[model samples]
Target: MTRKLNLLLATGLTSLMLLSPAFAENMLRVSYPEDPKSADAQMTTDFYTLPLNIFDRLVESETTGPGQSALVPGLAERWDVSDDGLTYTFHLRKDVKFHNGAVLTADDVVYTFDRMLNPATKALNTDILTFIAGAEERLDGKADSVSGLKALDDQTVQITLTKPYAAFLALLAAPGASIYNRAFTEAAGDQFGLTPETTNGTGPFILRDYTLNDSEMLEANDDYWRGRPKLDRLLIRVVSDPDTLRMLFESDEIDVFDMDFAPTQTPYFYGADQWKDHIVSGPRVGIYYYNINQLKKPFDDPRVRKAFQMSIDRQTILDKNFYGKGKLEDGVMPRGLRCYAPAEPIAYDPVKAKELLTEAGYPDGVEINLQQVSSWSSRWSDMNQIIQAQVAEAGFKAKIITTDEAAYLAARKAGDSDAYTQVWSADFNDPDNFFYTFFSETGSKTRGYNNNDPEVFAAIEKARGMTDPAERCKLYQDLTARIVDTDAAWVPLFSLDHSFVVQPRVKHFIVPWNGWSDMSYYNVEVE
Candidate 1:
């Protein structure tokens, strides 16, 4: 019982209740802090673990080793690219069938893209598919269907791009590109993905039951294109409280638990001798940083932004808040991705930060509204407080504002926050996923951060079309240096490690470097 009460923290307590007393031996039990808003991939930005298992994409990221993955075929058995790199022809597998017994064909492929791009669908993350040649026309109600998408035959689909995008395939491999059965989706109409019956896809599992904010039960699909999942069923329970989640794991009610929900106790659970072999940890391919709204007054000045960046001790935040669970990173692009180059570390010097602030016309001091959300991570409350005191030494007063997830996201998109906490995990293993998606003027508009530098925008736009890998990476490196080092667009912090604690009954499991997409639930074998 030494590990029991010692785990409880006073503030930031989550609410999780596990009602199931026991599970079958052939079942895999897991817990999520928040219930998935919907089973539809494109409709909501809910965690992909549920939808990825229920749906298949044109391609997928296959984990080859620890913290490494390569793009492999999923629904498409084979594909060929034109010499110009703008056209892709995918040959679908004839054996694939949806949960409702509809055959997967070229029509389904075309319908999938058409529905997502349709102005009425109002898909949440269609930005990933923006490069498709006629996506704009379809999304704007100018065209009935995407001109780029064409069904050559029952089993053949061809897609053209407006420009040559080197990361196009990787983009298809993302969760948002998941293929849906046109028949099932159309029949359900507005109710698609909201209930179990409408959440049909061709993935390895089929949803049997889903109780809102309680639990979801999925059964192995024998008709799955890939072999049936080894486990008979997947029981995903929503446990909101850290203490209750820990008690459930200790009582063997859950097979796997993510330490992120209870960050303060991560070191204790990780160091517990009894749970040593059950722990799995890897460097996440992402960055956790404080984005400063450049359009905001004081932050608009480069000197002021640089001073804010130099004010806080990032290492201290990593050490105290995370208990040394993450690695300090300087640039926007995280480690474990292609074109990763470790830059010189930004040293912590409060005196120099104060000097920069004085030069920027704030001789006495300045106050900044630091916004965060407790729902995301319990440690953000502690992390923000530490940052508040650290920056105070450099003549910056921090006003901590905590809000719910919905309000925080709305505020961030509207550029309502002066400075806010944000994290970006890679959807695909490409620098374009990081730089172009966040820094470009067009892309930044939706994600907040009103950086409209034409030079950065032009450089990113040029790099997207470069066929040469070396040249593209060099350009990305230059852009990263300018945004992060010179202009201090964001106070880049560290990337946390994806840490999960597993039970002995589970035989094998692995998450990609990014930690969320393509969990490979089909490969999970329970004893």
Candidate 2:
């Protein structure tokens, strides 16, 4: 009887061990090419905004659907929009606390916006705040305070807008509107945005450890306002080389990989009988193009700019570099977007280009230098080389200048380059951000290019001021046709398709239209 009892006990112990949960420090590792420059939520670059968007928000929800797109119960449970559509009254969630055990309140929200609008903070999205009644004046140092913003009580906050901006809800979704812990920012001094270690926000994860050009580690925030994250830990590794990233994915070193795979190479991993089940592809919300410096000589002439557009073989480039994974972009907006139009793009004609160059007084073949910043996925060095060869075929001697990523961005921002590649991802489901920024006189002009064309500017203004969605779409379509036909400031290249390879064990991974792969809903289920 004693022997039988011992045998039963041993059998029960073995069964319990087999059914036990995976406590081996569950971590979901992701690999990407670039490292984030800062954890500062307000940075305009996607590097900072991507992670910050996942970590914090004033309101969050999807667009292009029936759901309410804006100001939907993030830190604030509900909010009231005044009859005039100017004042926003927010009712804060009662039982919410920061990662550090401090209760979140209206004071924190007020502090976050005040600091964001402060000139000293140098927030990148200051322009977005212009909708606030006195935010523009305050940011310009013409006002004593942001009179449009006020805290009514510990649980209520009110914001006043100067006008009924159509993209206001989308703007709120941006990182510039994220609420930050006052204590953390004050204590970190100058190093606050550089890493997640010093920065604290009301999110589901906290930055535990990170090494530049190496890896980042995030641990779940048990005190998150919504609830604790399912995964105990998240790891992001920086693999600057795409080839290496692919190899790592094949070797199973990383669980997920993103980037368009070459057609020739796809069969090896994504064969019908092999990894087909793991590969996923979808449309992305991004525009890739070359910006022309309008301030530069020759290119300043619209005819010369139009001639340059006619010289490049966009289809060939897309086929070669993108592996036919993307479609040629004729305008700023891609197909499937609300405002997209099937307009005519400049055809490749060396003779016409030469004639235009001669007309611009560069008869002996214009000598121009082109600069392209290095990117991990695009292999920009190779792309520049091909572009050089193509442009030379059109009687133009082109020189390619390459720089490291950081220096390249600085030069582009300072308008120090004659021409450079640019990519813009939509912040919201609007065409205004797309066309306005690239062509508007006041928007980012890394290329030093400005339309100055009265008709073009008027069309953009009309679209911006229009509140009706159908009217806005029609105006934008007309604007896109004008820009493409005139070759106003850029050469629209191709719209890339986002690709991702995930491990079979991962579930509920969603790749949204914005190219944001939301990992919050992801969970691991062991086979």
Best by TM-score: 1
- lDDT of the candidates, in the order given: 0.81, 0.67
Question: Per-residue alpha-carbon lDDT of model 1 for 1-527, expressed as tens digits?
Answer: 11221132112121232224333567788877888878888887658877778999999877776567788999999999888989999999987989989899899999999999998999987887888899999999999989999999999999999989999988898888999888888898988888776788999988876778987777789888778889877878888898999898888888887887666568778778978779887778888888888777788888888888898899888888778888998888888776888866777889999999999999998878888886875567777888899999999988998788888888777766558766788878889988877788766655667777889989998988888989998888888888887778867899888788888888777756664633647888888
Q: List residue ranges in candidate 1 displaced over 4 A.
A: 1-23, 358-381, 399-416, 443-452, 515-518
Clashing pairs in 2: none
Q: How would you encode candidate 2's per-residue C-alpha lDDT over 487-510 as one tens digit per residue?
A: 557688887766677777665555
- Number of clashing pairs, model 1? 6
By lDDT, the best candidate is 1
CA lDDT for candidate 2: 0.67
Weakest 10 consecutive residues, lDDT, candidate 2? 15-24
Q: What is the RMSD of candidate 1?
A: 6.7
